[model samples]
Target: MIDPTLPLIDLHRHLDGSVRLETILDLGRQHNLPLPAMDLEGMRPYVQVTDPRPGVMAFITKFKWMVGSLVNYDACQRVAYENVEDARQEGIDYLELRFSPGFMAEPHSLDLQGVVEAVVDGVKKGTLDAGIDVNLIGILSRTYGPLAAQQELNALLHCRENITALDLAGDEANYPGELFVEHFQRARDASWQITVHAGEAAGPESVWQAIR
Candidate 1:
């Protein structure tokens, strides 16, 4: 039995952060990327947390491990493909995958644009392969400031068709929203949807500035 319509909407999610561990491990192995420093004790690794907050923190940290060794095209494709495949299994009909497409150059052989395109291509391919549709929304960490915002916005402008929106996340309490007003306006002017993470830990003011 299945309910065809329950009105499920996951408005905020982190793309690289949601990747499954086994998939990450497999890809890391294939790409020869070194994982984070987690000492293995008995059957479990010390950092393999599973108690809610710690679990989520440990989960997010895994991306650093996966990204550490990725230095070229094949690695990016592998990660994006694995992510979307997992999404399909969860009965996601419409999905928006968001990521901070930053500093994945050098060893990954990816320019920012290359990383964006690879993720988008992987989403499209995942739809056909997994029977679930996905759209990518590229993001920037506001703490990175307007210069990075402008670069992300410019990249979004160029890849407008693939990326559906622009978002600023990470460190909501310390960074001021007034700082990104200019870039957000630019993104708004360019017809990109803007959303930010606020009260998840802070207060209403963080979100207020974003929508303002």
Candidate 2:
């Protein structure tokens, strides 16, 4: 399992979902947010997956404290920057880090557009510090419903230049691709690459719908 000549590229990664636990505890304390645990070991079970999860939703629950720590724009930036550093430490030569501005903002009620800008800025700085090539992808979290997805899409579009692609994630079974056809169309119109999470919790029909 040794291939030194080949390049290491990670095409699918969620920046919002890859937040550091230490940072979460740090930010949680700084903002006086009510975290389930105060120390690393105590907080691990809440913010991490120690046991097997039943489904996507159960697995997604681990993200609560991860995002809860994002209490401000600065916190968002720090998370993004750390993601890049982590990727570099893992020997990744290039990465595409995706994020949902709406999801990241909802915990703290931060401005959507501001979150995008801060993430872009943080990635830019991280690229320099880590000496690795990185690309940004904007995600529309379908768990928030169509109207709310529109607002999420708008925030992604606000920083369209900085983002290399658009992805549809969250509750694949409940929110099918049909609901986001228009949203991806707009993303395509913007000349961004399209990616989606389909058929994971749903049926083959979801994959066919994504293709259509």
Candidate 3:
């Protein structure tokens, strides 16, 4: 086994996925958010993979509850800050945290740009405090369709300094990367780095489409 004390690098950690469970409970309580359950064990199945899931959709559902906790700018910032802190605690030396600002803002109808800024601010503070290097990636959900993806891309472009890249995430088996080719092209035209989530939930064709 790798030594627990050794420093590591994490390139694909998701900000939403990395949120500490305790933090989610705290946010829910502070915001008076209507959660399915009030306790950690009670909320586990809703926010985590506790059962044997056969498909990607089942895996993706775990995010919905956690995403609901990010109801404000402060909530977003706290999640980002804690994400980095958790990585630091795990001995992660360099981390690239990715998240969909649109997803984080959707539950509360928060501004996408504000969400991005808050996450960036939190990451800056966390990295400083933890002595780790970190970068952020903005995600565009494939399931949200073309218009929403374009809007997300626009938001990401506007916060280029805070965001290091654009990532395509969501149901790859059903919503292929080809569906957002134009949007990805636009992101590339704006000199933004691009990464696509493919082949994990789909076959090689999904990867080919993302690359194409």
Candidate 4:
């Protein structure tokens, strides 16, 4: 068997990734949002990661709907609160749920920071309700580059609490880590924890650069 004490860590488990389709359907009804007709057969490809598919486009699209349904405080609180209940069953303590505020923005110009704030509020609720130590991280998408990343950092600084880190993500094919050094450096200056997406798609060098 593989080493058991590898300290299983999940740097980036999308929140909506954990959401069941039934939940989406329920949310669709509650929020008066029309969800896309899911293709169950096509969805088979998405469940291949984390007990479900991690990189399926159809599954990915669901996050957009999830975001739409959860733009307000009540929805954010519910998701955050429920997440901890789910985490307890999984035995995943000290978890950090990294969210991409950039991608979660609403069509009505809902600032990226709004999404981060709502997510933090939800995370706080989850941690308190489950009596577990869970943390939230606002992941800045790499494709958006340093400017957008800095905005996320700035928002976190203004946020009251609940966030424990800021991460970089999005397609590894576009904009490698080196390009965002200055933003991360500024983050370091601000004393914010940092992480980046690497090794999942690109080479090991990508991981090295993200670390350095």
Candidate 5:
């Protein structure tokens, strides 16, 4: 599994989902948010998946603490910057970090547009500091339903030049790709590439819907 000559590219990593455990504990305490544990080892069981979860939704629950730690725009920026730094340390040549503004904003009621701006600024700084190439993909979290997804898309559109692609993620089985046809069309109109999280929690029909 050693390929020193070839470039290592990661196209499907989520910025919100890749937060370090130490940062989570630090942020939680900094904001006085209730954390299950004070130490890294104690925090692992709450944030990391030690055993197989019941289903995809159950697994998604683990992301609560990850995103929960993002209580403000500064925290959002820190996470994004750190993600690029992490990619560089992993010997990655390129990385695409995807995230949902609404999902990151909901728990703390942070401004959607502010979240996008912070991520863009953070990734830019990280790339410069780490000497790595990183692109951002804005995700429309479907679990929030079509209305909120629209808001999320609009916030992402505010920084269109900074984002390379548009993604649809969260609650695939309940929300489905069909609901986002127009959203992707808007993303295309803005000259953004489209990538959807399909068939992970749903069926082939979901994949077909994504393709269509």
Candidate 6:
């Protein structure tokens, strides 16, 4: 067995995707959120990857339910805190957690800045409690189109102190990185580090566009 005491690093954990199922159920009850299922087993297939599908859409569906649970600032903070706590338990010494504020706030009508601040606050508390180091990355979803992408990037810039980097995610096959070159350039000019999710659902050309 692997040593539990050994240090580990996780570089690409998505905050929305990493939320715990128990927490989701709790949030659903506390906020009276309308979830598809009330119990864990009934909810598992909706929020967790249980099927053997070999496509990105199948994986992306899990996040739809998970994001619904983030109905308030407290919920966002709780998920961020638990994400770090979970990482610590798994022997993760350093982690870079990423999330799209627009995506998290869309269903609940929460402000993007509020979501970012809550996650940052939770990361601060979680890192101190877990004795681990963590960094936050704000993601821009290419599927949201250019206008939404610009707004999300603007929010990231406003919270640049709390956010360590900016990431591009979602539907790499349908939306190419060249569509947001200006926004990425703006982020680079602001001195923020950039990470693009490419070549996973799409081909090498997508990755090439991201790099360009």
lDDT of 1 by residue, 177-203 (tens): 777788777777777787776665457
Q: Runs in model 1 with CA error above 4 Å?
A: 1-9, 36-49, 52-62, 103-109
**How high a TM-score does candidate 2 get?**
0.97
Clashing pairs in 5: none
Query: Model 5: per-residue lDDT, tens digit, 1-212?
Result: 78699999998899998999989999998999898888999989887799989777888898999999999999999999999999999999999999999989988999999999999999999999999889899999999999899999999999999999999989988998888888999999999999898898998889888887
Runs in model 3 deviating more than 4 A are 1-6
Cα lDDT tens digits, model 3, 1-212, are 87877778999999987777788889889889888888889988888887799888788888887888888899899899999999988888999999997788888899988888899899999998999999888899888787888888787888787777889998787788878889878878877788998898889988888877
TM-score of each: 0.79, 0.97, 0.93, 0.76, 0.97, 0.94
Order of models, best TM-score first: 5, 2, 6, 3, 1, 4
Per-residue C-alpha lDDT of model 4 across residues 106-191, encoded as one tens digit per residue: 43356766766777777777777777677676677776776777776677666625566667776666677877788777667766
Query: How far in Å is the alpha carbon of 181 misplaced in model 2?
Result: 0.7
- The most accurate candidate by lDDT is 5
C-alpha lDDT of all candidate models, in order: 0.64, 0.90, 0.86, 0.64, 0.93, 0.88
Instruction: Give the winner by TM-score.
Output: 5
TM-score head-to-head 3 vs 5, winner? 5
What digit string (tens of lDDT, one per residue) describes model 2 on residues 2-97? 799887999988888898889988988888989888898998999778999999889989998898888888999999999999999999999999
For residue 180, give model 6's deviation from the true position in Å: 0.8
